[model samples]
Target chain A: MNLTLKVWRQSGPDDEGRLVRYEIEDVSPDMSFLEMLDVLNERLILAGDDPVAFDHDCREGICGMCSMMIDGVAHGPQKNTTTCQLHMRHYKDGDTIVIEPWRARPFPVVKDLVVDRSAFDRIIQAGGFISVPAGSAPDAHAMPVPKVDADDAFDAATCIGCGACVAACPNGSASLFTAAKITHLGLLPQGQPERGSRARAMVEQMDEEGFGGCTNTGECTAVCPKGIPLDTIARMNADYLRASRKSG
Target chain B: MTATIDRGKATEPVTQIPSRPRRSRRRVSSNSLKAVMAVSGAVLVLFLVLHMAGNLKIFAGAESFNGYAAWLREVGYPLLPHRGLLTLLEAGLVVAIAAHMYSAIVLARRAANARPVKYAAKVKSRADGYATRTMRWGGVIVFFFVIYHLLDMTFGVANPEGHEATPFDRMVAGFDPSRWYITVFYVISVVMVGLHLRHGLWSALQTLGLARRYPVLKASAAGLSALLTLGFLVVPLAITFGVVR
Candidate 1:
């Protein structure tokens, strides 16, 4: 299939970006979206032009590094699938694909189709971890965790940090992302020691990162490549309130 | 042709970017505000019911009605003392209204900015319930009505024709003959208020994380809307029908 690509191109973080057009023909249906882009880059190189830069590692969709806003929807039209897993077959021949980096105040564009997602890292660094001391690995079955609680914790642990939720959100809120982390650790026995402070610290960090407040629009869940549920956010809120109240 | 051949001959290793695990933080500020709205609204509804019931004393003639009013004034508005409790309740009401309005405005703004595509079709299907659909608009209308009501009742503002003064006199004048247009308008406004409270209550609960499952949330939302609508409408209809005079 032949497709026209409108790809965002930027020189650096400080530079303004614009969509530049490129045409690629003879794309195979089986080729993953990234592979097709690889073909286009090969063509660009032959023509003495710079190849389009995008972030991707594992094309298996678990990495969340392959972030792109295709046609205004985060991760394209596919539900619960990342961009790297999306294939050329999703588009018709001669389809004009508009590809751009994630749009958010925190995630600034670094180059073509690649934005610096370090703001998320900073938020995590602020307090998204369990404060366990360094020690020998414990037996796997030592701590007895309820099946239901473990299941909920596992569900919350699936966040991939792609910033797709923020890009999809109108206010660019990071509630879904932050909530998942808070709930995942807060549910475990190991996390109980610092759960209260952790919730407070993470919430304060989230606000400090300048992410907008959650409006319960459910768009985060809709665009989440991992299908992280919005209920996780509710859990985080309850935890935060409890933590803050106790501290107060 | 030479450039293409040279480009094909060149080789570079592909570097892999590591996948970073994202920590999801779901803030329940909106939900918390909704909870506040729901609880406060329920309290307000209770107050309104008792108020209407007290006003029903008019049906027993002037002595009973005025006596009830005098007793209320003398009691210094029990459940809200004239000085301390009244001040506290008034302050709390102001906070609740501010929070509710602030959260609603913010949510509305976010919703307005979130739509990525504009549909060209003339007919659009709405997935939201009737209450959710009209929340912002309904809230605005009710807000304006509340202001007008306070002015009319509390400050002894003249009626549309500038005839009546004092809340007691206005209440008697407004209900004695019960003008058809006034009755219709009052009924409609009260119905809107009911609609607003109904959905607002359930949604507030959901926001507070009380309703986790969608089915549970949906059912509660619908039930609350229906109950508030029915509960609020009963007294107004009674007055309009001369059942409560």
Candidate 2:
């Protein structure tokens, strides 16, 4: 397949970025989207031109490291598939693909297609953890979590911290991502003690990060590569409300 | 494989992640503001339902409609001053509207600030329904329409028959066939209300954490908004078409 690629390029965090077009010929349909980018980068390197820089660690899609907006859709058009997992067969010959970095105030562009997602790490640091003793492992099955709670926690745990929710949200809200972390920890027995403080602290941190409030638009869930449910947001709201009341 | 992966230093104690000190806070959190919006919106919705029901009294003839309007003022007459309950209700509505508008302005501004740079390609989504997209602008239109509606009906300033006229006369004169423009504006504004209410009702449910548990809330939101739109439309449309005097 022959294709036209319009990729965003920026020299630094403060540099003005714009889409730069490149045409490639004889592309394979079997190549993953990133692999095709690798091909493009190889050619640019051979010609002594600067190579495009994008963040990707585990191309298997679980690492949540690969972040790019393909045609204004987070990750790509393929539902529940990250940019690294999206294959070229989804496209055809003579197709034009426009790729750009995540556009959000909280997620600033570090370079070409590489936005700093440290805001997410900061949110996690705010509360996304349990208070476990450091000395030794606890006895097996000591804190037997309910099956239903375990299942729900597992579902919320699938969030890969990709920041796609913020990128795709019309409000650029991080509610879905923040709520996923809150839900994953809040549902278990061990998480019960710090539950109230966790909800309050994490939500406060999220707001301080300059992410917008959730309006229940569901665009974030629609574009989420991990398929994080919107229900987590409701749960987060409920928890926050309860926490606020108790704290007051 | 010349890639260098820095997985934090192995000797660094992973016991506890350093947590930031809590900042001094006075501003209301976004979640709390959302609850305020939801509660206030819900109050306004209930008021609309009662108002629509009251308007339906017109079909019973002018006497019944006027009598119903008079009775509203006389509510709790012996126990309280004339129009006391009505005034209290109006005061509550003003509070609701104020809270709702304040939250909306704050949240909308935050949403704008969240994304400094716009995407080159238009963001398309199957889930971005018409109601969801029109919320901000539709809200503005609804706000203006409410002011106009109060002038025409409650205060009688915009009505053909001014303050001294009965409620029935004001309503009839307001939507008379010759004054088709008023009816047109009324229809357009009511439709906008319906669209706004559709998304808002569901959003309120979601914010209050009820919609997730009760999936029927989504359909109910649509159905209730449509019903309210129809309920409000029938009277003006009936008057304009000469179906009601």
Candidate 2 interface CA RMSD, Å: 2.9
Which residue pairs collide, candidate 2? none
**First chain TM-score, candidate 2:** 0.98
Which run of 10 residues does model 1 chain A get worst, by summed lDDT? A208-217
Best by DockQ: 2
Tens digit of per-residue lDDT, candidate 2, span A70-149: 99899989999999999999999999999999999888888899888878988889995678876899999988998999
State how far residue A140 of model 2 sits from its true place (Å): 3.8
Candidate 1, residues A80-150, lDDT tens digits: the string is 98999898888999899888888766676778888778777877887755666559887789889999999
lDDT of all predictions: 0.71, 0.91
Candidate 2 segments exceeding 4 Å error: B1-26, B213-215
Chain A TM-score values, per prediction = 0.96, 0.98
Model 1 residue runs over 4 Å out of place are A128-134, B1-91, B102-142, B148-158, B161-203, B206-209, B229-245
User: What is the TM-score of each candidate's chain B when compared with the real chain B?
Assistant: 0.65, 0.89
Candidate 1 chain B: minimum summed lDDT over ten consecutive residues — where?
A: B118-127
Worst 10 residues of 2 chain B by lDDT: B14-23
